[model samples]
Target chain A: MSVLFFELAMTAYLVVAVLFMVYLAGRSETLTRACQVGTVVGFLFHSLALGQQWIAGGGFPVTNQFEAASFFSWTLVLVFLVIDVRYKSHVLGAFVVPLAFLSVLSAAFLRGNVQTIDPGLRGLGLTLHTSLILLGATAFCLSFAAGIMYLIQMRLLKSKHFNALYHHLPPLNACDWLIGRGVLVGFPLTTLGILSGAVGAKFVWGSYWDFSPKQNLSALIWAYYLVMLVGRYTLGIRAKRAAYMAVLGFVAVALSFVGLDALMGETRHF
Target chain B: MNLIVVGLSHKTAPVEVRERLAFKATQLGEVCRQVTDQSAADEVMILSTCNRVEVYAVAPNVDDGFATVSAFLSRCADGMDVKALGPHLYHYPGNDAIGHMFRVASSLDSMVLGEPQILGQFKDAFEAALNAKSTGMVLNKIAKKAISVAKRVRTETKIAENAVSISYAAVELARKVFADLHHQRVMLLGAGEMAELALRHLISAGVREVVLSTRTTENAHKLAEALCAEGGPPVRVVPFADYAAILPEVDIVLCSTGAPDYVIGPKQVSAALRARGHRPMFLIDISVPRNIDPATAHVGDAYVYDIDDLQSVVEANLEERQAEARKAMVIIDEEVDTTARWIRSLEVVPTITALKGHAEAIARGEVERVLNRLPNLGEKERKLIEGLGPAIINKLLHNPLSSLRKEAQERGGRDMVETTRKLFALPDEGAAGDAPAGGDDE
Candidate 1:
């Protein structure tokens, strides 16, 4: 049942991504409206799929790559819509929804079928830890998209060349604001999640500071976001410089997210 | 009924002759009344713009209406050669008249093609004619259809998309950037004729707040005072150094100065973009040595269009309008066909009204005789019997009425209408259309 819902959501996101790209290509209002409607419908279906997975496991169904990726994409869409409305930069959707689509699409291929819930996962602490980490990751994903747009806009400005995309992209100031918001919000959530996980580790493995690969990656992710915040606020680094830092941070986040699953064989983040 | 248009325009008449024949609005009511009082036309409207003077009328007979209007036109401008004016005065009758009107209202017949002023002029003429009690159902229907045709030509075609003038082009591009100009603020970075012209267009386009900033405070104050006196949004004078400081709240910056260096740089705009919360800003640099930095176009959300860019936009727009005018012709043809069919349907109105009246008279006579023979009938039974007569009459006439309407839409609809009118003994004067019940919506 969860797999059926997951496929349905993937189809909706695919439609949204295609329509948004078309809207950008031609500046068509009809296609823009269609893309907006598709994103909203896809968001609803993605939630239903997450709910089905949760019911299947009788908990927060974030125990594998498929489940975590699905939740991550859903949170990205939610944050993107908020930023899009607040900034009045609807063109950002053309850049953001594709990121959401790719994550959910990759989830469909992963081993996402429901499995027996481990007794170690049966608690509020682990549930809170996983949900917060996925949400924080979604915020960082948005920062990555904004960072890419900022660099493109920066090149256009520096080269003194004008094109359709140069005009359509949000002002460089808005991109900077987007990156700042992601770090400012994502940093605290990630901190709490890491702390909660270490606390839960004491109950599951009887050690607060385990040398597991997942723990090491989480710490690395936390340190990177901390440096980004300090570089922006204290060092007075912002705009293009801050955007570059965000891209680097996003790369680190991605490696630990998908690369760990590929390189380490497994992670207790499940 | 007959439709006729008699006028002199920029096409055939020289400007001098047009001015001579033009009727000033002050005397328009009196002149329109004189023509209508002569009973030369059933309905009359006068459109007297600087480019043309036209009279649209519904007449009892085309020939007599033509004579009366031609004499009126000749008398409007005394001392002008009536014979010389003869060659200038042109006339269109029947469907040709409607086709001419639709084209004129849609700006196809304008001296400046795709210009919007003619539609407003036509509407003002229509309202004047209505106020003078000179137009009725047919003329009202024609006027309303013409307005819609003009509107469709504007929207469905790209005829009005690009601005034709330099200042207007800047305003048009700004409109494209920001959909609503009412809430947008404008800042003029320098003092020059180009800035003044662009400012005028922006004010007319609905930008209500303006700031004038220049290197010299006195010059800025002088321009600001002059602009405020010109009847627009209040113009505030700001120091030149404050341009970047005030840039955050402004939605548009019109820069035209004799400066050798860039007045607004990318860094300044980047800072403003951040301060303004990333709202899009339109920078129109019309000076020869451009005032705003060209690199600022790369700023996220800042759209820069220089003088060259605006000129290219105008050139491209002219070509677009030329392409769109062909499409507008198709729309005009459709409007003409629709109006012709409606007039054809109206041609059969007298026959229907006459036939119904004739049938009802006979129905009433027979029902009265039968009721007198059955005086013991109950009230409900009496009412039922009375209702039966009209019901039977209506049923008997339904087939013929519908067929008559169908024939009105065919190739020989006018002939079908004429034959029906003769068979029913109805007059060609359109008696039913002039009746109170036949009046169009108020």
Candidate 2:
């Protein structure tokens, strides 16, 4: 049942992505409304899918790679829907929806990679560690989307090419603000995610410090985002520089979460 | 009835003639009533803008309506003779007129193609005619359809999305840099006509405040006072020497100084960007020989566009508008055909009614003649015989009448109406006179 709902949600997101692309090419209020409706429908199915998973697994469903990726995308869509309604930035969906679709697509492909969590590890500490990290990653995904838009808009501004993409994009300040906000929200959550993960490690692995590749990479990803947050607020590294950092930090996060885990076969830490 | 449009636009008439013929908004209702009263037209509307003054009318005869409206137009303007206005006037009848109205309302026929003001002007003219009760069924339907068609064109095409003027281009560029101008400040360095125009556009876009600085203190103070009187965001006058100090605080800077050298350079802009924590700033230099250093564009987060650059942007946008205008024309053509067909269908109603009435009259007369010969028959039997006559007539006429109605809604439907009239020996007057009334109920 959970798989069925996940597939349904993925199909809705795919349709939303296509609608947004058409809207970007030829802007119309009707198309925007359609995209909004599609997003809401997809979000509902996604929530149902997650709820089904939670009930079936007897815990918050972020234990395995499939559940983690699915949760990441669900949170991304949730944040996008909030921003879309609050800011009335309908065009932002053209950039964000595709990322959500791809995240869910990866989860579908990794469906067989679910690792059964030990019953002893089913506690608040493990749930917090996984859910907080996934939420933080979701925020970074927003920054990544905003960063890409900023670079495209910046190039258009510098080259004086007011093409369709340039016109559809949000203003440079808006993109920069999103990038800043994402880092601001993501950094603290990541800090707590790392701290909680370490606390959970003592109970499960019999030691808090293991120096494993997954643990090392998680620390590296957290530090990278920390640099971005500090550079944006205190060091005056902003606009183009901040956009570049946001993009690079997301790359590091992706590498640590997906690449490092894949390289070390049969890893206990995700 | 024929739908006709008789008037001159900027394309056919000079400004001297157009201005003289333009009707005042307050006088529109009276003028429309006068046209309907004096002309052969049953319905009348006057659309008078600075670029064009057109009279839309539904008349019994196209030639007579055109002549009457042309003469009235010449008389409305003082010192303009009919011979002088004759060369300027243009007349379109039937489908041509409907197509023209759609194009005009959509701004496809505007002097500046794809402008937005013409739609509002068209609506006002329509409202005036409605207020005066000068427009009947035909004019009202056409006018309403034109308004919706204009809205459709605006949404379906990017015809009015881009700025076509330099000052408006500045505003568009500013918008591209700042998501919302309501919180952003603008600084005007020195004074020039184009610079002030750009400043006005920015203020209307909801800029937070305006900072004015000029080489002369008096000019700055006067400009500030004038801007403040406009009742927008507050305007502050800063001394020329202190203008650079507020660089980091302002988001947009407009420079049009008369100085021989550059008033703002890369060093000052880069310093300001650093102080502002690298927030983006838009610099527009409209001064001759340039007021801001061109190299400032290389500075991160600072976009510098000079006069030539702004002009190029306007040119590019105009070209895009022209391309979009072609697309709008296609939409207009499709709607014109649909509306024209619907209007033609109105002509079929009275013909069908007449055809049904003719058949029933013969049936009733024959039934009465036969009943007189069978006075001894029972009451129920007599009623059944009377009903049989009309029932046969109705069944025989149903196919022909329905086909006539169907043919009337397609192209070349007029020939079908004429043929049906000749075949049935129906009076032509009913088809012409009852069309407007039939359309009213619809």
Candidate 3:
């Protein structure tokens, strides 16, 4: 469809993301619910607009950086919605929305015009890798948010300043449990994403192990969370400790996905 | 007149000291008799609860009554002077005492404020005094009025409606945040009554998992069994030394132990948080000596509610209940005044009796003399004169009886009744017969 319409929808998602973050900080359930509604609405429009672009291109819309990025962000929101249904915590939406919104916005700004889908890049492995990574990233973002909330709550308790804001946050135990589960789900999917990316690399570049920065960084993120989970189960590391580690792992994952991708200059080196 | 409560509560006196002065159900009669015999109190009642022992009485000479009760207490306390316990005793007289009784009955003065047991205990004491026939008119009025006031307070206010105890309040706070306890896991640090009671509330609120950690294994097992029976998830006992081992599993931590210092601190909590990856933890420190150090709460993402924090919630709840209680007090006051007025109307019996007696006497004397003078008159005519004497007395007393009743409804009607009785030279209640004699027969 029209680029302007898609950009406007993406902007609406951006505003919703910022609003939800504020809601999380303010601990306003009403605003959070509104954010959730806004997100669902924005995603519906984003999907419709993306579908139009796919029809115009005459294939799967994974041709350029813009289409791939938009698709990745779309997958993230879809994954976040599924998790939100399961966990029923508006808290996850607080983090996932920002990341998804930012990626969509990035796609809008970076890709000014919709172009033809590259026939060579349109493979099953690439689709699987991108979808897995998008979902994993969404779940990891939730863990990251939970970890941050947990740390902030812990500090408030430690300072002996039991104010209204302090009580609004979820308990450390709850945060830890949620983040652990989130990490449990996200970690494997991220590993799969890396594996499938390797498979997709062989399909495109004729190499299974290219040792790219994205690959190396994704492995590091996986290793970080793996240690966090193992430490909790075997050595009796608690929810609080697990949450901190998950947060650290998510940061690593983000660096590998977007931060490293940006540094690598539009996939030319890869 | 001054009112004094020369007694001890759970805080001031030990159980031994309290038991020594305790008024048992059987001894209540004897105690009432002894108190009345020793003092000029027209009204006396003893309120003896497990946590407190108090005697409420009304006297014309407040000082003398206090002195008499103090002397009685001093004598009963053996060689221990009443001065030893004088500071603990609170003295409020007349209006203040009335207010105190109102507050106490309303559960405002209770150690665990808003408990309903005290009001029932108060009622029992009142009933005991009534059975012993020790309560005077004023004391009877006050006791009954206090009960009605307490009823109003309980009914109108939500004071006694919720969990008011510190442990229970902490659990309530957690529930408010979480909404559902059935999926939550709770770790209890001690076998304290307060902590256990809190756990019981949590269990009832749908907490599925309960972990008990105490210094004693026996206590842990016992608590585990009790919790299981109370519908809590299968309670597991964690060793006191294994705080870290169980810390990860529990969603909520309730720390109330007899430790001299902090057992759970920031270092351990922080270590746990880091190991578990910044997970959320809810911690409640209810121990007086503070089992959990204040610093431990700072280890990022842990929400802590201490005793002082919980107290404010309780205080706010109490203030709300108290405001409602004040409204109820007005209702009680009206009820008391109406009851008192009815009691005061009893004094009118002698006046009514005297008026009837005077009218009857005049009718009888005049009729008997006239009957003798008309000895030759027919039996029917003599009977007619006798009947006329009865009619004359009834007609004469009707207006006055109605006026006396109207006066009885007025303030100081007791004085008016006395004046009317004296004008007719009526005897006091004892000489005139029982105050309510033959009134119930019809």
Candidate 4:
């Protein structure tokens, strides 16, 4: 039942992504509302799917690549819902929802890779640690999407030619505010999650810092964000430059979160 | 139903003729009632705007319908020459009238193509007719469909997406550049007519602060007073010599001076850009000889759109709207066909009723005759026989009835209605028009 719900949500998200893309090109209000409905329905089923897994197995599901991918994509949907509802910019979904679709589809590809739930992943601390990290990933994706929007809008503003998207997309100041809000919340959550993960690791493996591939990658992601925040705070890096840095930082974080897991085969990484 | 439209619009009549024929809005309800009482049209509506004066009606007879509306218009414009107005009058009957309604509602017939004001005017006319009890089922249905068709044309086409006028184009460009214009400040260069016009648009858009400068301060004050009553944006007058000094604090610059030489230069724009932190600024130079240096646009975030540029934008927008208007016409054609089908389908209802009535009467008589000849028929079976007779008759008639309805939905469905009435041997009273009327006959 959980898998069925997951697949249904994945299909809905796929349709939503396509709908949003078409809506951007067509600038149809009907299609825009349909996209919002699709996103909400997909989110509802995704929540049910994740809830069913925890109810059936008695714990949070992040034991394998499939679970990890699905869980992260669900978090991304939650973030999109918040942004879409709060900002009321249908144009933002056109840029951000494709990433959600890709992540969920990639989870579908990793279907056979579902390993048994590791005992180390069952504790409350481990669940909290991973959930916080997923939330942070959600914030980073939003920031990254806003950054891309900012750059495109800037380029269009510089050139004096515009499409419908240019008219509908939020102004550069709004994009910067979104990124700033993302960093403000995401930085602290990521920091605490990493620290909590270290504590959970010590409790399970008798070590606080292992310098494993995952740890190293996570540290690199954290350091890059730290430098960006510091630059924003101290050096007064605002608007376009800050937007570019956000895109770059999010790329590194995505690589660390998704790519590092496959490279480190024997090293247990979440 | 015979729907007729007798009207004169900007396409056919001059403004002088239109003004002479238009109805007063305050007396619209009374005039609408008069038309309903005077004409053979069962339902009546009068649409009178600045560009057109039209009367739409659903009439029992098209000839009387046109005569009544024409006489009403002619009588209303008592002092005008009927001979001069005769050439400008346009009368359409039946489906052609419906198509005209669709076109007018969709802004195809508007002087400024795809303008939204006509639909609102139509709604007002519809409401006036409704208040006068002059619109019945046919006109009511058509009015609703006309509104929906207009809405579809707006959303489904790009007809109203871009601005078509120079001042409106400037305002639209400002909207594209700034997320919120309510907080922005505007500086007006010289009090040319175009400058005042652009200022009106800006002020209406919620521009809070406006610095108006001209060689004549009194003219600036007059323009400012015309724009604001009280407790609005303070339109302060600036000396023409110091207008350039205040450029750094303003977000938009509207230059429409008569000066042949450039009033704003690249150096000044560069200084303003630095003070404004390189923020986006719109410079609309609507002057004929051009008041701003073209090189001023070279500065980062300083957008210079001259009069010719704005006119070119308007032309491009007009071209786009023309293309979308073609698409809208296609939509309107489909709607017109749908509406025509709906009108034709109304004919089938009475025919089907008469057919069912005739068949049921025959079935009842045959069942009574059978019951009367039976010797020892049980009471329950006799009752069952009586009920089964009408059931069988209805079942047998269902196929032909539904087929007639389906034919009524198709092209040339009017012929199908006529043929059905003749073949079924049903009474032909109200089988064609079917508009509601009080009579001794059902």
* Candidate closest to the true structure, highest TM-score: 2
What are the per-residue Cα lDDT tens digits for candidate 1 across B120-232?
98998888888887887888889889989999999888777657778898886676555557878999988779778999889988897999898898998988888778888
* lDDT scores of the candidates, listed in order: 0.80, 0.89, 0.71, 0.82
Model 3 residue B113 lDDT?
Answer: 66
lDDT of 4 at A148: 93
Q: Tell me the deviation in Å of residue B385 in model 1.
A: 4.6
Model 4 C-alpha lDDT per residue in residues B413-436, reported as the tens digit of each score: 667767877887777755434534
Worst 10 residues of 2 chain B by lDDT: B433-442
Candidate 2 wrongly placed segments (more than 4 Å): A1-58, A85-122, A210-217, A263-267, B75-83, B349-401, B411-436, B439-441
Off by over 4 Å in 3: A21-29, A113-119, A157-168, A235-238, A266-270, B1-165, B172-193, B207-283, B292-305, B312-442
Model 3 lDDT, full chain set: 0.71
lDDT of 1 at B42: 81
lDDT of 3 by residue, A1-270 (tens): 547657766877888888875775652356866777887887887888789877987756665667777876787777677767776766667666787777887777658654434557666776677777767776777778778876776665556455445645666566767777777888788789878878887878899886666667667777877777677777555555665676777777666755775677544311
Candidate 2, B156: how far from true, in Å?
A: 2.7
Writing each residue's lDDT as its tens digit, candidate 3 over B200-236 gives 7787788778888999878999878866776647788
Error of 1 at A74 (Å): 2.9
What lDDT score goes with residue B26 in model 2? 96
Residue A267 error, candidate 2, Å = 4.4
Docking class of 1: incorrect
Which candidate gets the maximum lDDT versus the true structure?
A: 2
Clash pairs, model 4 backbone: none
Which segments of candidate 4 are over 4 A away from where they belong? A1-19, A29-70, A101-133, A194-236, A255-270, B16-44, B63-84, B126-162, B211-215, B234-249, B259-279, B288-304, B307-442
